[model samples]
Target: MKIDDVVKDTLGRWAEEATVPQGLADRALRRRRRSRVRAFAVMAGATATVVATALTVPALVQPSGGEAGVILAEGKPADDPAISLTGPPEVSADPDATPPTKLVATEKTAMYAYYTWDNEKISDTRQILKQTWYLYNPDSATYEKTPWAAVDVAAGGHVAVLEEAQARRVGLLGPEGQVRWIDLEQPASQLKWSPDGRKLLLVSYAANPNEQGVFDEDGSSREIVPVTRTGFSVVDVAAGQAFFRPLPAGGDAWGRSVDLHWSDDGTLIWDWDTGSESSPPPRRFYDLEGRPHAAPPDPADTGQEAGLSPTGRFSAIHSPDRSAIAAVRDTSSGAITPLKPVAGHWIEQAIAWSGDDHLITWACELKGSAGCEVSEFRNRLLLVSVDGRQAVPLTGFRQNSQKPGSWEPLFARR
Candidate 1:
């Protein structure tokens, strides 16, 4: 069948779904999900000739492993130059309103690089999450819109995207107009840039990895399970090479956290190894070759997302006594510093360190409550000092909404 016909029929059945909400099925022109569904349909019927033709990248080359790894650019690849963040002053706060296109970032982090999710029902048991990416453009000092289904930005403003939602290949666009591409032997849906912006960790799956299908579609339960992840590939853009390895098979994948990220040191990549159905999956680590490896040790483990603030001075860990309040602890003395709460919000997790003392975090909504709701859905990106004295707003309040206005922010290190 034609790709368009296949996509339409699948979506047609989903629109008639009574179990899910209309927000997913509405399919307005602006919020159309054809790109998301087309991914799955193309994978099932796409031929080798069609894929080769669609690649279009003229400078296609093979990886050192004898597999396809295309590098498209003129002239010899040059060394990565130094990158710095400078522009308008770092703004302290903004009124809680629409999604901010203009964002202020620190030397180490950028708020303009983020993404929002869209859900599409494919079957009684399966659904797909489409990510709309907004990458930071240092040239304009503002966020530039990107409609690519999957993309990731690095600390140095380099971007890795799934050229298309099909996930067969990965595309690289550097800050200096340097273009590169990689053809993973398998289909991959997720792309994460390494800390140094030198490599990409591409997670491959039997089907599109974003497929968070209903845990039990025949029943009324709404729990979601990730699609089967087969393996991953690590592509070194400068070297113009990629290495693929399959994930160890075993364990119950139901409701497992499938997102894989780079180790703090960037030497290893990590994910969970679901062993038993009754117990939680242990955090498993792997080397670049996808071999079983040890986890990255937290020398001064603060139990906070931002492990240690730059100078190893402060961290935002949970309050020793009050679980609702987050404590700014001095790693040296292990003393809990008092955190001042905002008018109707309290900082929860620390995303990245803005400076030696300040952190980019989420300040959740408190809605007239005496104590802050720890996991309250309503929150926004905020910059708070480790001393808890200064509280600044980066982006306005966002929540788990169908509208991109309230979606999770994917911050990239700058």
Candidate 2:
């Protein structure tokens, strides 16, 4: 019997297998057509490439530097007319200095930094907070204090912030600086905006220490307090309500860990603790409503790094070791297309999905053992395409060098 037939014969034993070939081919053709249209657009606009976008607002762009206030072809900005190019500019060059039409995040030394949804606005942790928000307006290249710090402007201009002196209360601010609602009971330390910019997910520890009589306002505790609580809560911005989702119960499970990611369409994709196995088999996904939504598995091997495409039609997952990237044919179809190797050790680095399924932002260490201890030395950024598997270095991340210009994220114009 032929290899195809032999594999087809035993495929039934698996929990899930590939869908029909014709369907996969059709989707691939559609993807190519979409890509061609985008390529034509990029060629038409030779000045820059867009990385993201929001409602009606021009996505942020990183203008190359040179000629001071001009975008260079190589993506680096030149020294101001007042200062010599020999060293970094010490002082601001006139508030009138044209903020680069884009905000490029190059090597930064600030102790804390906040990159917003549009990347147009940034908050240096050293300066801004709930009471004070330093707003960076790229259009005029100026900044001022706002009511809230680090607002998610990509969505409907709603701002999420932690209330001052209230350890557990998080308040949402409106455009005119009005309080919308507050989650007084729950204490979510970290807040994140959904990919589509519609909702905000607050990840917090489930247990409230104040309720258990562990520590008083004076930092006094009478007796030992044992408690059990750990998980996250999903808040609906439009309806003004929240639902708490508990973490799975089991031994050897990593509790309330980091790295919980949301796709463009707002689907939360994360790994379930299947013990400390070498690979951590059986990854799962949850929709906004908290429903099981795995998009069919590949017939050949187990999948890891399962991510949804920007359009949410197709999802891609990488091998555990980053050898290859396999994507499901579509939302409902289980068929898989294994793309060629795009990066080495993808799990150790950061992967960003651009406007569509065929492209992704590859950020990884350029060299070294890809170790936790040495990650700081390996910091580098790469731009790669899923289809071409071509890797290109973004010069803005050159080690110890100043960035070209402030290039903000401009969404791929759909």
Candidate 3:
């Protein structure tokens, strides 16, 4: 009789009539359980005045001109400095050289941009000089050079998205070394592969590039821009169909970074707001047809940007002490268990989950007495376990003191 009951009845009928996949149903049940817990927590503390005020106002925060103020929403220390370090070891061997260290996980391979002071130049830029692609072979304990310029690699090493030198086209490299080219109308800034490896999301830029300016003592300033694209494209690899969607002007003006990701089921796309300091930006979702969809309710305000594993079973979180420590959080129970801390180093970013038990993360050493600046600090790829075991070094030495720091390491299951 009630509206909520009517909606539940409609959903029940739909579930009974439709042939739903078991995996999808299982995931839905888990989400519903989590949502109910979150709802109960909200209802316990919510008041009429708070609810009325929230409905009447927009929750957007404007960014200041210079460096954004550190809000520390996750209980991290306000004075926490950026990690810094020395350059990596110079390449003395062949052109396709690998790191000196070896990884314990021999089943996975890593793809990264190898930087050296010497090499042929395709285009002379501040960052791209003498940069090439290399594949780390765990079995041989060596690095193999690949011809294609890989931007991102998919899971299982089945597909890769690449960009050719001055070609103005994007290529999708398949398993057999075959290439399928997708012509772009504008230059692309970022490429991300879906968790299922079936779709690739490409973000492109136009006139007003996404950049920030840093001023020197003399008042002269230089701009540091990463990705300048304002539009996005979702490519279906199997069907070879690419659809371009242009973002509304000023849609992403508030954030310092733009993050795009595919939903777990691969049926929707999420554009997360990384700029808000007070709370996690309410995520915006889009259906496969590019239509805007209502976002699902949150269970609780975790107050941290917790990185969820590919399976959504656990979250990679930082310890409250803000030391060089990492932990695993069980999503269902919200219990935090500390992973064995990598001595003298802190987790910078949790890149991906290698499997059920292992996580691939970037870590930097503890700050020196002189303090560590981000420009001088280097990060190394580490393979760590959930049970707090010793962390394994996967990549070469620390990132070389290049202009743009180090290349982000990409992991593929072998």
Sorted by TM-score, highest first, which candidate order results? 1, 3, 2
lDDT (10s digit) by residue, model 2, range 279-323: 434445666555667734442121222245546565555322333
Best-performing candidate as measured by TM-score: 1
Per-residue CA lDDT of candidate 3, range 282-337, in tens? 56777755678766445222322335665667876654443334567888898886
Alpha carbon deviation, residue 349, candidate 3 (Å): 4.3
Model 1 lDDT tens row, 1-414? 999999999999988885331112222321211112211211111112212432553344433344444433454232332123565445533446436666556555665445556677788767776655555455554455564566665655555667554466676653443445566777777677776778888777665556665556355676545456677888887766677789844223443245466776679987655553433345678888878887767633455556567677877665565434456787778788755466566665565677676777767765343344534445777777667777777777675434533455555555
- Model 3 weakest lDDT span, ten residues long: 37-46
Model 2 error, position 306 (Å)? 8.3
Q: For each candidate, what TM-score against the reference?
A: 0.72, 0.41, 0.57
Cα distance off (Å), candidate 1, residue 142: 3.5
What is the full ranking by lDDT, best candidate first? 1, 3, 2
Each candidate: RMSD:
13.2, 18.8, 23.0
Clash pairs, model 1 backbone = 155-413
Model 3: number of backbone collisions: 6
